[model samples]
Target: MDLRPARAHEAGLLTELALESKGYWDYDEAFLAACRDELTLIPADVERRRTTVAEEDGRVLGFTTLDGIPPEGALGMMFIAPGAIGRGIGRRLFEHTAAKARRLGFARLTIDADPNAEPFYRAMGAVRIGETPSGSIPGRVLPLMEYVLTPR
Candidate 1:
């Protein structure tokens, strides 16, 4: 697999991939529907953020986005295709993202992670600093994780 910048034309494809990945946690239809907007990747998002895709054989296995200015940033999104789950793709994506963040001079990268993905983030060396209200679900709270980027 290779990591590359996502093209604007891939917005829809990436959006579907994100929803499928999120659904891997077994969220019901209503919840998924509610999340659609927040998860949607517009062409501008693809062009503006450090959005990248992990592709093999021209197929995207996963994608992630890094957003904000140096010294502080957010892992805006991290999604793995449902079929690619548990294949260590998520690990690769996170490591690559962390490295990118460090290279970009970020001191810390925050993540608003799905509950089911919290353990994965923990494994990636992030600590849950707190919780934030979900942007999608009104009553839901998501784990807020932070990875302190060290100088390479």
Candidate 2:
């Protein structure tokens, strides 16, 4: 697979991939509908953040985005194509994102992770910090996590 910076024009495709990845968890339509706006990615977001895409044979398989600057950077988005799950693609994207955050002088990276994705983030060394109210759903909470970057 070829991992590289995401191009602006690819935002739509990446957004679709994210939704598909999220749908893999089998949430109901109402839940998915509520998340639509939050999952949407626009070109400006791509231009403003550090976004990376993993592709193979010209097909995008996964992607991740890092936003803000240290001492508090954020993992803004991360998604693996439904077919690409369980193949370590998410791990590769995460490691790349963490290293990039470190290089950018971030002391730590924060993630408001999906409950389904908490295990993956935990395995990647993110510690559960707390839960935050979800912006889209009333009374719903999302897991907040942090990954500390060792000084280089």
At residue 86, give the lDDT of candidate 1.
90
Superposing all C-alpha atoms, what RMSD in Å does each candidate have to the true structure?
A: 0.7, 1.0
Q: What ranges in model 1 sit over 4 Å off?
A: none
lDDT of 1 by residue, 1-152 (tens): 89888999999999999999999999999999999999999999996888989999999999999999999999999999999999899999888988998998999999999999999999999999999999999889999999999987
Candidate number achieving the greatest TM-score relative to the actual structure = 1
Which of the numbered candidates is closest to the native, going by highest lDDT?
Answer: 1
Model 2: per-residue Cα lDDT over 1-152, one tens digit each:
98899999998998889889989999888988888898888898886888899999999999999999678889999999999899999999999988888888999988999999999999999999999889779999999999999965
Clashes per candidate, residues 3 or more apart or on different chains: 0, 0
lDDT for position 103 in model 2: 86
